[model samples]
Target chain A: MTSWMKKCLVVAASAAMTVGMTAIASADDVTLEFQQWWGVELPDGALQEIVDGFTQESGVAIELLSNPYADTKTQVAAGAATGTMADVVGLDGSWVYDFAKQEAIANLSELMEADGYDDSQLSDQIKYEGSTYMIPVVNFAYPLYVNLDILEEAGVEEIPTTWTEFMDACAKISENTDYAAYCIPLNTEAPNGIQNQFSSWLWASGGSLLKDGKPGLTDNELLANLVDYFKEMKENGYLSDGVEAMHEQDMVNEFENGRLAFMVDGISHLTTIKKESPDLNFTYAPMPKADDYDGKSGLDVACWGIGIAENCEHKEEAMAFIEYMMSPEVNAKLSQLANAFPGNSTAEPDYSENDELFLKAFEIFQDGYAINEFTGAPTAEDLMRSMNEQLILYFDGDTASVDDMLAATQEAWEAAYN
Target chain B: MNAKLKKKLTPYGYLLPTIILMMILLVIPIVMVIDYSLYDNVIANKNPVFVGLSNYAAVLKDSAFWTAVGHTLFFVIVSIAAHMIIGMVFALILNTRYLSTRTKGIFRAIYALPWMFTASVIAITWRMLLDPNGVLNYFILLFHLSPEKVTFLASRDIALQSVTLINIWSGYPFYMISILAGLQGISPDLYEAAALDGADAVHSFTGVTIPQLRPILISLIMLDFVWTLQQFALIWMTTGGGPVNATETVSTWIYKQGFTKFQYSMASTGAVILLIVCTIIGIFYVRHQKAEE
Candidate 1:
C-alpha cells in the first residue's frame, strides 16, 4: 500500500471501531424496543432519524415496530396474555382502557415526576383506578366544522353555540341552501361521518349515554330532550334525506365540495381539509352547548396517549423515549404530523403558520370538556356506540318517536353497563 | 397423465414439490379457515375456543345475516341473468359478417374492457361517477332531465340496485368474452347447414348456439353465482351496507361484524352459512343439469 493510503486506512479503522463501540454500548446499555401502530406516522425515513436521535442523546438504541389499530390491539392483547410485550406502546385512547383493565400497562407517575410533569400541568382526567397509566401524547376534540360559504349562502352571520341556536342555525342553513345541516353515522362501530356529526349535539345538550355507572334512562328530562332534538333535526330538512346511508368519506366529500353546511369532525381532519382543498372557506367552532353547563363550553376529548408495557425488559429506556416524544420539539412535530395538537400544555408546539380559522380550533378547545371526564376506559364509549347506531334514523326523520329511541338507547346502555 | 404421475413418483417425484407447495399454500389455508370457522377467535391467538354450533346459531339469529343473504341472492340472480343475456347478445353481435373480420375482433375486444379493469377501481369510479354532486348527476342537472338530484348510493331503497348495476356492468363483459370464444370454436358447417335449410336468426341460435353453449353457460352461471356471493368491493366502496341494511351483502356483513364490531365468531358463522348456502345451490344446480344430460 502507498504511504498516504496506509494513513487513510488507519483513520477509517479508528472511525469504524468507534462506531462499533457505540453500537455495542447501545445494545448492552438500555436500548428500549418501542412499538407503535403509527408506523404510518413515521414517514419514509423518519423512524431511522428518531432512533438515531434518541440513541445519541440517551445512549439507547431504540427499535420501533408498527401495525394498524386493530392488528396492534389484537397482537398486544395476545402478547400480554401470553407474557410478551414491547418496552413502550403507542396505544389509541379507546383501546387503552381495555389493555389497562387487562393489567397490561406500567404506572408512569414517577416517570412523569422525573420528567418534570405534574398534575397542575397534566390533567388528572387521564388517571384510571387512582393511577396514571399513560402519558398523553396527542389529543383531538370533536367540534362543529362549519362551511362559512353555506352559512353565508343562508345569510346567517354566526354559528350557534347552544342547542336551540344550533337548531335555529340548522333550519336557516337548510332554508338558505339545499345543504343538509348534518349527516348520521349508520354503523354501531367504525367512523360513520353522519353519526359522529350528530353525537356532538346530544353531548352539547347536557346529556350523555351514561349518567354514573348506570344508563342514562333514569333521567327522563335529558332523554326526552336529546331524542326529541334529534327527531326534530331529522323531521326538518336539517339532516340529509337519509344520512344514515352515507359512509365517513362521503361526509368529508360533501363538506369539502360544499354540499353540506356543518360537520362534526376532530382536530385530525384540519390538516386533511387544509391540504385537500386549501381554498375552501370554513371554520371550526366548539361543540354546541349541552344543557348541563347551562352557559359553559365543553368538548368531547379524544386524546391519544402512550403507555409503557409492564412486560417490557427495558423500562427506563422506554420511559426516556416516551418523555422524548412529549418534549416540546418532538411533541409539536408529531402533533403537526398527526394533524392533532400537543397533549401537554407546558410547551405549545409551533402553531405560527395557522390562519385565524385554523388557530381558532385550539382556542375553542381552551374551554373544552372531556367525553367522559371521570372514566378513562372505552367500555362506556363502546356501550354508547351500540345505541348511537340508532342515531342515523334520528337524523333521518324516520324515527318513530324520540321516546322510542331514548328507550332503546337506555335499554342498550343498561345491557352494556350490566 | 403419465408425466404428471411420473413427476409425483417417477416423473411424479418431480410433482412432489408442487403437491407439497399446494398443500402448504392452498389446502392448509382452506383447512385453517374451516378450523377458524368452527372456533370462537382465531385471529390473534393461534388457539381458539371451541364453540361448536354457537357461532352458527348466532349467525342464524342475526337479522343482518338474513339481510345479507337476501342481498347476496339478489345480486347473484340479477348479475348472472344480465351476464348470460347480455353476453349472448354481444356474442351474436360479434359473430356478424357484415363488418370485416378484424372489425369484429376489435368490437369483441372493446366489449371486454370493463372486465379488464380491477373490480376495486371499477367500483371506486362508479362511486365517484354516481355521487349526487358527482359527474353524472352534475350533467343530469345541467341537461335538466331529472327534476331532482338522485342519491343513487345514498338511499337505502336504491343502494343495492345501484351497486348491482355496477357489478352487472363489470361482470357481463367477461362472460361476453368467454362466450364469444365459445362462439369462435363452433364449426362453420353447422351454421352453414342451418342457414342452407333457411333457419332464421332466432332459430339458428335456439337450435345450434343455445344447445352447444349450454355446458359453458351452466358452468359460467355456477361459477359466477359462487363468486358473486363474495363480491365485497362494489358494495363496500359504494354503500358499505348502510342507509339501514339496504346494501348489506353476506361478505360485507361478515367483514363488518368481524373487523369493525370485533365479533370474529359471529363473522365466521356468517361465512360458514354463506359457504353452506352456496355449496348447496351449486350441488343442486350441477346435479340437476347432470340428470338432464
Candidate 2:
C-alpha cells in the first residue's frame, strides 16, 4: 500500500473511534419506550414532532412504537409474555380494568402524586377500583349525525329528542325521500364498534348491560324495550335492507352518498365528512332518550390513556416523559394538531368558539348526558361483546325471539363472570 | 470415537439444525398449547389455575363448538369438491396434445392468477363484487332477472355458500397444477396401447389415467383437507364469523375466543382439538398409503 493511503486510513479509523466513544458517553442514562395505537392520527407526523419536543426538554430519548388500535392489545400481550414490554403503553380507557386485573400494568398512584398530577384534571375513565392506573390522553364522544338537507326535504322541522318522535321522523324521512332514515349497526364487524354505539341506546333507555357487577340482560326491562324498538325499525323499513352486513365505514359512506339520513359516529368524523363532502349540509345532535325514560343519556365515549407497564425498568423516566407530554401547552398543541379534545381539564379545546357542527357536538358532549359507561362497568367489555355477538343474531332474524337472546346472553354472561 | 460411531452420528450432525428448529418451532408450541388447555388461563389472570380436563369437557359440551365444526365441515366438503371437479376439467383441457405450447402456457398462467394474490386481497375483491349494490347485483338488475336484490353475503342462508365459493376460487389452482403435473407424467405409450385395444377415450381415462393419478390425488387431497381446516384470513376478512356466526369456522372461532374474548384456555382447548383431528386424518392417510402399496 502507498504510505499516504495508509496514513489516511489510520486517521479515518481514529476519527471514527473518537466519534463512537463520544456517542457512548453522551447516551442518556435511561431510555424509555412509548407504545401507542394512534398511527392514523390527524395532522400526520404530529406525534413524532411532540416526542421530539419531549426529548429535547427531558433529554430522555423516548422510542415510539406505533400500531393500530385493534392489534395494540394483542401486541402488548405478546410483549408481556416475552418480557420485552414497552415502558409506556397507550390503551383504550375501557381496557384499564382488564389490564389491571391481570396486573400487567403498574399502579401509577405514586408516580402521579410525585409528579403533582391532579386526578380532577383528567377524565374519570382512567380510574379503576379507586386506583388510577392510567392518565387520560385523548377523549372522543359519539353523537348522532343528521343530514340537514334530508331533514328539510322530509319536512321534519324539529329534531327528535325522544324515541317515539325519533321513530316518527325516521318513518317520515323514508316516506319523503328514497333513502333510509338510520343506519343501524346490525353488523359492525368489530366488537368495539357495536359496543360503543349500542351503549348509547342502552343508556338512553335508562338501562345498562351490567348491574352491580352482574349481567343485567334479562333483568332490565328497558333492554327488552330497546330490542323491540330495533325490531320495529327493521320491520318498518326505517333501516337499510342490507343492515345485516353493514359496517361502520359502509354506514358513513352511505350517509355521505345521501342514501341515509342519520348515523352515530365519533366527533373526529366531523373533519373527515367535511373534507370528503365539502358541499353536504350535516349537523350533529345528542343521542335521543326513550319516551318513557325522562333521564339524560348519551353514547359511551371512547378515550385513549397512557399506562406504565408493570415490567417497565425506567418508571421515573417514563413518568417524566408523560408529564412533559401532558403539560398544558404541549397537550393543547397536540389537541389542536390532531383535532382531538384536551386530555387535561386546564387545556380546553377552542372548538366552542367556532360556529360549526363541532361546536354543537362539544356542547352536547359536556352537557352531562354523555357518561363514560365503559368505566362505569369495568366488566362491560366482555358483557357487551357477548351481547353484540348474540344480539346481532337476533337482529338478523336468526334467533327465535328477543326473549331467547336475553336468556342466552344472561346465561353466557353468568358463565363468563362466574 | 470409533469410525462406525462417527459415521452414524455424522448424518445426525447434518440434520441437527433442522431437528433443533422443529423442536423449537413445532414441539414447544404444541406442548405449550396442550399445557395451556388444561388450565383456567384468562388473559387478565396473572396466574393460571389448573383445571385438568374441564376445558376439554367444556369444549365438548358447548353447542357453539359443534355449530362451528359443522360450518367448517360444510365449507371444506363443498369447496374441495368444487376444486377437484373444476381442476380436473381444466387439467384435462390443458393436457390435450392439440393445444399449442404457447397456448398451454397462457392457460396455465390464467389458471394460476388467483394463487398469485393474497387471500385478503381476493376476499376484499369478492366482497365488493357480491355486495348488495355491487356489480353482480347490478348485472342481475340489468337483466331484470329477479325483482328483488340478492344479498349474497348478508343473508344467513347464503353467506356460508358465498364464502365457500370464494375459497374454492382461491384454492382450485393448487389442485389444477397438481393434477396437470400428474397427467403430464402418464406415458403417451399407454394411451397408444389402450387405443390399440379398442378402448375409447372414456374407458382410457377411467382405467389408465385415474389409476395413475390415484397416489397424487390422495396426497393432495389430504393436504387440502388440512389447509381448508385452518383457513382463517379469507373468511375473517370477509364475514368475520358473523351474520350471526353462520359462517364461523373452527379457526375463526378459535381466534375470536383467544384474541376477542381473552379466553386463552378455551381457545387453546379448541386448538388441541383441531390438532388431534388433523393427526387422526394424517394417520389414516398414512395407513391408506400403506394399504395401496
Candidate 3:
C-alpha cells in the first residue's frame, strides 16, 4: 500500500475506537427522572439531598421533578395516559389500584425479586391483585390536635377519651371560649378531608368502610353512629363555621392561629405548626373513640409512596434507586426529615434531636394500627367526594335522614366500584 | 402543471401547514375523545369494550349531571348579563367626554386589574377574602353589620351567586375593552345628527350608540357565553362545586368524572355534550359575523 493511504486508514481506525469508547461511557451514565410531591413538604433541599446520596452511592444520576401534591398527581396521571411518565414516581396509595390495573406502574414485587431486594423489610406495600405496585417510603398518621390554651380557657379539665366526653368538651369550649370547639374541613374541592378527618372518626372506633374488599357502607352501624356524632356536633354549634368551604390547610391555619380547639389532622403538620406559630400550645393525641367500643383503634395514615413507571427504560437503575431509598438508614433519615414514620419496619428514626410532639405522635402511631380504606380502593377520590357531597347536603338540612344520606353514598360508591 | 391549476393549488400549499396543525392539535384529539366516549373504562383498562351511547345515556340520567346543567345555565346566563351591564357602564365611563384623558386612563387601569390576575390567583384571593374570618367579615363585625360572620363562599344559599359575582369581576374587562373600541369607531356625526333631530342624550344613546354597537355586543355576548359556560378553573379552585353541588357546572362535573373518578367515558360524554352546545353557539356566531361582513 501507498504511505498516504495507510495514514488515512490509521486515522479512521482511531476515530472509530474513540467513538466506541464514548458510547460505552455514555451507556453507563443513565439519568433517571424522579417525580414527587415530597420536595415541598420536606425541608428545603432534603429530597434533593436524598437523590444526591443515591447518585453518589451508585453511578446512576437522578433528575428530581418536584411539584405540589395535587399538581403532581395530575401531571403523573397525564404522563401515564401519554406513556411519558417519569422513571421513578412518588405515588399516593389511592392511585395504586388504578395505576396498577392500567399497567401504568411496574410490578414492584417482580422488580424486587429481580433485584433480590428484601421485601420483608418493608412495613407496607400498596398491592393490587396480589402484586405490589408501590412501596411507601414514609407514613404520616392522622391524630387529633388539641389546643391546650383553648381547653384551659374553656375550663376543660382533662382531654376527652370517649365520644360522650368529647361532646361535653366541645360544648364547654363553645360556651366559654370565643374559639370554635372543633373544625373538620369538608371542602369538596380537595375532598380528602372526608378520608383524613370524617372517616377517621369511624376508623378510630375500629370501624370498617369495606367488608371483604367491597363497598360496606350499607349497614355499617359504626358509620351511622359516626355520622350522628358529627350531626350532633353541627347541631350544637360545636363544629367550626364554614366547614363547607374549609380545606385541610384552612383547618391547620385555624389551629395555628388558636381559633380552633381541636382538629383531627396529620402529624406532619406538627413541624408546620411549630414553624408558623411558635407560641401555640398544642399537643397530638389519639382520636376519640366510641364509648362502648374497646377494640384497637385504626389511625388513618397517608404516605409518600414510591413506584417505577412501567415504561421506564432503565429498570435496573430504577430498582436500585428504590432500594437505596428504602434502605433502613436512608428511610429513617427521610422519615425524620418529613416528621413521619419510617416505611421500613426496622428503620427507627432518631427522635432525640426532634420535637417532643413528634416523639409523642410516634408513640400514638405505634399504639394504633395504621388504616386508610381509601388507600388502594378503586376510584378513591370519587368515593370521598360522594360521601363529602352527601354530608354537605345533610349538614345543610337538605337530606331526608342520615340513613338516606348513607344510602345515597352507598349507591354512588357501588356505582364507582362496579 | 398548468398555470390555472398551479394558482389554485398554491393557496392550498400556503394553507397546508395550518391545516395539518389543526388536524393534529384539534381534530384528532376531538375524534379520540368521541371514540373514548363510546367505550367503557378507556385509559385505565387494558381491553375496553365499546358501549355504544350507553355512556351518554348514563351521563344524561345522572341527577348530578342535571344539577350541573341547571347550575351552568344559571352561571352562564347571570355572568353574561352582569358582564354586559358592567362592561357597558365602565366603557361608557371611560369613553365619556366629561372625564379627562388621564382620569379615564387611571380608571381603565383600575377596572382592568381583575383581568390581570390569573384564575388561580383570583380564586385564592377571593377565597381568603370570603372566608368567615376573612377581612370582609372583620369589616362586617367592626360595623356591626350582622351579629355573626357571613360565609360568603361556604353557604349553600349564596355560594353560586358568590362565584357568579367573581366570574363577572374577572370577565367584564374583555367586554369593556371590545365595546370601547367599537364605541370609538362610531361616527360622531351620527350623534350630532341625532341631536339635530331633537333627540336627548338618552335618545341619542339608545338610537345612535346602541345601533352602532349592536354587532360588537352580539359577538361579545356569544363569545362570553361559550367561555363562561366552560368556566372550570375558577369554580374548581374556589368551591369545587361544593356546598352540595350548588355550583357544580358541567366543566367541573366532567373534571370530577374523568380526573377524580377515573371514568373517562362519562367525562368524554359530558364533554361531547358541552361541545355540541358550544358548536350550536359557534354556528350562530359564524352566521352573525358573516352577515356583518
Top candidate by TM-score? 3
Q: In terms of DockQ, which candidate is strongest?
A: 3
Q: Between candidates 2 and 3, name the one with more favorable TM-score.
A: 3
CAPRI verdict (incorrect, acceptable, medium, high) for model 3:
medium
Task: Indicate whether candidate 1 or candidate 2 has the larger DockQ.
Answer: 2
lDDT of 1 by residue, A285-367 (tens): 87777545575444666666788987787777777787787776777777666656676666566777655655787787776
Which 10 residues in a row give candidate 1 chain B its minimum summed lDDT? Answer: B256-265
TM-score of candidate 1 chain B vs. the reference = 0.87
lDDT of 2 by residue, A178-234 (tens): 878987655524555446556677775557777776777885788888887877887
- Calculate DockQ per candidate and list them: 0.20, 0.38, 0.68
Clash counts for the predictions, in order: 25, 0, 0
Predicted structure 3, TM vs. truth: 0.95
In candidate 3, the residue pairs with backbone N, CA or C atoms under 3 Å apart (3 or more residues apart, or in different chains) clash, namely: none
Give the per-residue lDDT of model 1 (tens digit) for B57-125: 777887878878888889889989998899988988897768899998788788988988997799778
